[model samples]
Structure formats: C-alpha cells, structure tokens
Target chain A: MVDVKSVANPLFLREEELRQAIEMLFFAYRDFTGGPDEMLAEIGLGRAHHRVIYFVGRNPGITVSELLKILRITKQSLSRVLSHLVEEEFIIQTPGERDRRQRLLTLTQKGVELERRLTADQRERIADAFRKAGADAVQGFKLVLHGIIDAPDRERFDVSGGPTHAPVARVGNKIAGDKMPGTKIAGIKR
Target chain B: MVDVKSVANPLFLREEELRQAIEMLFFAYRDFTGGPDEMLAEIGLGRAHHRVIYFVGRNPGITVSELLKILRITKQSLSRVLSHLVEEEFIIQTPGERDRRQRLLTLTQKGVELERRLTADQRERIADAFRKAGADAVQGFKLVLHGIIDAPDRERFDVSGGPTHAPVARVGNKIAGDKMPGTKIAGIKR
Candidate 1:
C-alpha cells in the first residue's frame, strides 16, 4: 500500500492540477445526477424535489428548520416545492413528539417508493465505481470528499467510519440542542 | 503509493457504503458550489450562469450548440441565460470563422474577472484538500471520480494524465469530428 503520509506531491497544488480537479468535479457531478434528473423530469419534479425526498427518507421525522439547515436554502425557496410534495401525498408532516409546534417531515409509502427508484440507479453507479477502484481508493475518495466539506458541517457527517454510525442522529442532536433542547427530532426510528 | 491493485475490500460495495458515498457527494457538491452560488446570487444570477461563464472561460470561442451539448440543457433553457449574459456584455457571441452559421462564445474582460473571482475560493479549497490528501489519495480520488462518470463521456475527459494534456481540446476534436469535420471549434488561441 502506498503510504499516504509519505507521498506528498506538491505538484498537485499547481494551477493546472487545480483546474483539472474543478472540471472533474463538474463532469462527475453532472453525470452522477444525470439519471435522477431524467427520472425527476418525467414527473415535473426538479432536483429540489429529489433532494427533499432523499433527505427526508434518510432522516425520518426531521424538522423543517433542521432540513432548511441541511439544504442551506431559504425557507421561502423550500416552501413551494415542499407544499407540492405534501399535496401530492409523497410526504407527510407530523408535529414533533416533544414540540408540537415543530413539524417533522417523513416520506409516505409513495415517497419511499419514489426515493428508492430515484436512488437505485445512483446507488448502483456508485457501487460499481467503488468496486472497481478498490478499498484504498474508496478511502481516498471519502477523505477528499470529506475535506471538501466545510469544517463545521464535517462533524455532522461521518465520512471516516463504518455504516453503524448515524450521521443524521448527530445532526438531530445538534439542531435539537440549538432549537428544541432535550427534544428528539431526528430520533424517530425507521 | 498504495498499490491500488492489492487492496480490494468487498465491503465497500455494501448498501450502507453506497448510501454514504451518495451523501458525501451531495454534501461535498453543495459546499463546493456554495461560495460561487452566493456570489452569483448577488449578481442576479444562479448556478446556470456560473456554469456558462466557467465553460466559456475554459474553452474560449466554444460554439453555442457545443456548449448546449456540454450543459445538457435545451435551447429554450439556455436562451434566457445566454441573452442576459450577452446583453450584460459578460459574454460575447461571434459567428464561427469557418462556419458563419455557428456562434462562438467567449467571455469579456468582465466575465473573465468574475470567473476568476468565483473559482478562486473553490480552487483554493480543492488545492488544500489535494495537498492534504497526498499523491496516492489524489490519484485514487481522480480514479474514483473518473469512474463515476458515464462511459460514453469518459473518453472526452482525460483524467489520468498530467498538466500538459487538455481535456477541452479533446472535447473540441470529438465534437468537430461528428459535426464540423476538418473544422476547429476549440482551436481558438486564447
């Protein structure tokens, strides 16, 4: 195995290398989302809708403010897309157990199905890549991606460990501490 | 360097691992674009505008149809953004030297400055991560990202090499081959 600590290529910081990195990200992300984009377009739902479904499916019973924080979009921007999803019966909102005023969002059965279908192609694509790249590459991929995230949000995501750790639970605890202390917003069991 | 061939962990293909990869991409892309998105918002633009500026800046004198193909957006979708950019003088469109019917897009001084400022933060972020990740990890990162791209478009990108190779040039050659044979759309000297 190549010692990650021993092989530090200063050339990687060159402008050309940096620009290459930029373009790679541009193309990779474009292709990564391509399948879901086509699928969502058929239903007249854009990326915003897909994101809402994906996050809510990931973190069942997540509150509106917590989601807004996760998405980093304004409440006004999320309102219309959210209303549409709820009206379409793809998502259902329930008041938080501790804080009745806090609406916790979860996917309906239909939402779960749509989320599964939308994510299936993506999951397979990622799996194929990881499988081909091997364990070391996967580790490198995760480290680089985690580094790309802002530090404050990095802790909220566990990019370093196994699957048993729950990132959403941490996000819930953080959000709950700030907004609804002692309340279990992200603690809703799947 | 990690002998990428030696360490093949099968567990990386598990569903949870796949999901983590998905979330990492989601969060990473979001943060990667965050700085530019804010700057674009201030100028009454969005990610679409930033993308147009970026690609046009990268491949000066790139053709309209060629750009549309790269963006995977329709004529109708690009029309408004293109018009606004042209009207605002951030970008200029001139007829191709060989094919007068084809409009070649290039950024103005203002556009170049904007693109520079917009990408500075992102470039720095990437460079920092790459420097920290070391050569092996960077190699692995590139391989995984390249693998994430679809097969058809994969050849169009040269992710395996050093700074001397130009990916946009390859894209130009490919596009020129299919449509404008023996004509150079991407050969404009910057």
Candidate 2:
C-alpha cells in the first residue's frame, strides 16, 4: 500500500510516520469511547453527557465555568447538556458557598452509579491495553498524550500531586477522600 | 486529590495509574482534534463529516461497505452524512466495476482540498507531540495505541509494508503511487 520509492526520502518518511500517528490516534480514541458510547446510547445520552458525568464525578464541586474551560464547548451547548442531566436527576447544582451566584455541579446517586458503570467499561479497555503493552509502553503512552494536550491543560495531569487551583468546596457533607473506588482526580498523583 | 495511604497499596497504585491514563486520553483527544474541529465548524461541518472526507481521501474508490466497516456507523447515520457531502459536490460516488450494485466513493477536487487542510491541522499536532516525546516515546505510543484498538482493526496499522486486503479500484487517472504528499494508506509502512 506504500510507495517504496518515497520511503527512501527522509522527509517523506517523517511525514508517513506522522500520518500513521494521526490515524492510530483516531482509531484508538474511537475504540476507547466505543463501550461508553453504546451504554450512553441505551440511556438516550451521548458522549457529551458521559463527559459531564465523568468530570462531575471526578470533581464533586466543579463549577460550570470550570467545566466550560475543560470541555471547550460553547455556553449554550453545555447548558443544553447540563439541563438534560439535571432534569433527569443525574446531576444536581448548588450555589457555591463563597459566591452565591456561582453554581457548582455534583453527581447524584444515580449519576454516580452511571458514571461508575461507564468508567468501568473504559477502565477495562485501558487496563487490557496497558497489560499488553507493558510498563514501558504505558509510560510512553502517557508522556506522548501529555505532550499532545494543550500546555495549560497539561498542568492538570502533572505528577506532583499538588492542587493546581483553589479547592472547590466539597458538597453534601461528603467526608474527605470519600471518592469512588479506583478513581483518581485530575493532577492528583499517587 | 489522591489519598497518600492508598498509594502504598500496589492494587490501588495500579488503579490510579489506569485512571490517569484514561483522563490523559480524554484530554489528549480533545486537544488533538481541537484545530480540525474549529476549521470544520467554520464551514458548517462536524467531525463526522471530516471523518468521511478523510477516509475517502485516503482510500479513493473505497466502497460504501468498506467505509461503513471502517467508521462503524449505522447505515442510516452514514446515509445522512454521505448525502450532505454528495450534494455539496465534495464527494462523488460511482458504481463498482466488479459489482455494479456496490457504490465506490471518492473525493472530488474540493473534497481532496478540504481533506488535506483538515489533515494538515491534525498533522501539525501529532508532529509536535512526536518531536517533543522523542523517537522512543513515539514508538511506545504507537505500541500502546495498537494494543487498544480492536483485534480486527489492528491489521490496519501492521507497519509491515504489505497490503492486508485486496486492492480496490483506483478512480480517475490517478496513477499508481501518485498520491498526495505526506499522506499514507492504512497499514502501509516503509
């Protein structure tokens, strides 16, 4: 399928390598999300909903603005998705203690269960890949992916285990460190 | 934030590692597609349209069934997107030579141009990541991603410089080995 003559050119080889990388990323992401997509479809939710559930479950008191920055979607788009989740009781919004006008989002019990199930499907996929690729490959995967992320957001995955921003208030009197089993908050290193 | 006590447990550490991999993938994919998505949005197209344009550009004269298999989208959904591209003259479809009933899809000149533009955006992202992550990390990245893909699709990125399937008919006067620069067909390697 490749033109053998072109392979002799160093520049062309680099281009080919990059092209393969692009396709590999596409296929990897597609299959990575496939399991969750099917589950979301069954519930009449889509990828957007899963993202909200995933992030809110990760950050119990994440504000709408914070989510907007993470998702990079327009305010109107997030509003539609957020309203659907709220109307279905998968998520609840509370006014922030520090700023009464700001709404912080948290997952309801239903939301938590759904997020767990969805994430479990994804976790299985990644675990299998990690197991097959071995530790070295897994490390490379993370490093390359970190490089691909925008610089500002790359701070979210730093291994320092330090808080990158002011701590959002934990809602519902949840005890500290009472997160779901097998979960890690963004940028929270072990 | 992670619980320091939990980090001492090997099982918990593995879980944490997997969770971090999952989050990194989500953010990486979001930022990776960011540029192409913006360009497509400006032209009233979404990622779905871009995928169709991309695969078609890569495999000219690719049959609809082949495309359906690659994209894994429902026939109805593909029909909607395909119709839009056909109407816009971005893509053209012709009956297969061996099987007249089968529709073989190829890009029009406009589609080719658009595919190149969108791919260039993605190419820039991957090239930067590869350069930053270095050759060893890039190899590791591909290995891990290859593991993540489904077993059947893994054949698409074999990197053996061999064709995995029968060749589809080449449309137009596009000479054999005459392809867009910096592009590669699936599974082709140096």
- Interface Cα root-mean-square deviation for all models: 9.9, 8.3
How high a TM-score does candidate 2 get? 0.80
Please give the TM-score of chain B in predicted model 1. 0.79
State in Å the error of residue B104, model 2: 2.0
Give the TM-scores of the predictions, in the order they appear: 0.78, 0.80
Candidate number achieving the greatest TM-score relative to the actual structure: 2
lDDT of model 1, residue A143: 78
Task: Tell me the number of clashing residue pairs for each predicted model.
Answer: 2, 0
DockQ per model, Cα: 0.30, 0.38
Fraction of native A-B contacts kept, per candidate = 0.56, 0.69
> What is the docking quality class of candidate 2?
acceptable
lDDT of 1 by residue, A1-190 (tens): 3323213543432665677678778878999999999999999999999999998888888889888988988999999899999999999999888789988899999999999999998998987888788777787787788789887666544444332324222222232133334423222211
- Candidate 2 residues A3-115, lDDT tens each? 54453465776766777788888898999999999999999999999999988888788888788887888989999999999999999999988789878899999999999
Residue-level lDDT tens digits of model 1 in B1-190: 3322213443432655677778888888999999999999999999999989988987788888888877889999999899999999999999978779988889999999999999998998997888777666776787788799887555454454332323222222222133435323222211
Worst 10-residue lDDT window for candidate 2 chain B reads B161-170
